[model samples]
Target: MEYIASEALINARASTVWEVITDAGNLTVWESGITAIDGELRNGGTIRIKTADAGGRTLRLRVQQMPGEVMTWTSRLPLGLLKRTRTFTLSLQAGLTHLTVKEEVSGPLAAFLGNTRPDTSQHLNEYVHAVTNRAELLDRAS
Candidate 1:
């Protein structure tokens, strides 16, 4: 499996950060890489996200699991040759929220596409930064 992940400690409540991260309608406000998102973000729901970095490919992801502090979304490439799962986890540590976003790709095509895939590491970092920055900004405003 090929993996890309990013994490950061945000000085905010876990619930506060979770609210901002899970709200599909507000994703583009903080995540500059994402141009738009359609559909809801709940267990069993489906969401389609359009991103700038991924050559504007609309990622249709399903909400595999969504609990209070963690959410998992899964997507499959054409012909089911490749599958990708992205997870977001949050926890409170020492009065700060530890946020993590991780994506794993697996299947027959994973090895072939691993090297040619877009800048996943950079995108992951941007995701983390956006979430943390938004959380901190909202925390201060409240």
Candidate 2:
């Protein structure tokens, strides 16, 4: 399996961070490379995402979440040939919120897709930064 992860300490409450992340409409504002999200982010929901990196292609994913604690989005190829899972975790540390975002790809076809997969390290970092900024800004406004 191959994975990319980023972590940040956000100057906001866990609830604020979770609210920012779970709102699909707000994703385009903070999630780097994502242009649009077509669907809600909720358990058993499906969303189609348009990204700058996909050349106008849309990626569909299934959503599963534990409210403010964790959220996972899974995208899979037919017959389990390839699967990608992106998880977001939020926790309170002292007076700040600790956020971790990770994406893992695995399956029988993972080796094949590895060559085609674009490096997402920078994207993940930008996402974390944007989220932290947005959440902190909102936290202050409240």
Top lDDT prediction, candidate number: 2
* Candidate 2: pairs in clash: none
lDDT for each candidate structure: 0.86, 0.90
How does each model score on TM-score?
A: 0.93, 0.95
Whole-model alpha-carbon lDDT for candidate 1 = 0.86
For 16-133, candidate 2 gives per-residue lDDT tens digits of 9999988888788765568989999999999999887777889999999999999999999999899999999998898899999999999999988755766677888888998999
- lDDT per residue (tens digit) for residues 45-127 in model 1: 99998998778688899995556588998999788799999899988888899988999999899989956888988988988
**Model 1: which ten-residue window has the lowest total lDDT?**
64-73
Q: Backbone clashes in each candidate structure, one number apiece?
A: 0, 0
lDDT of 1 at 19: 85
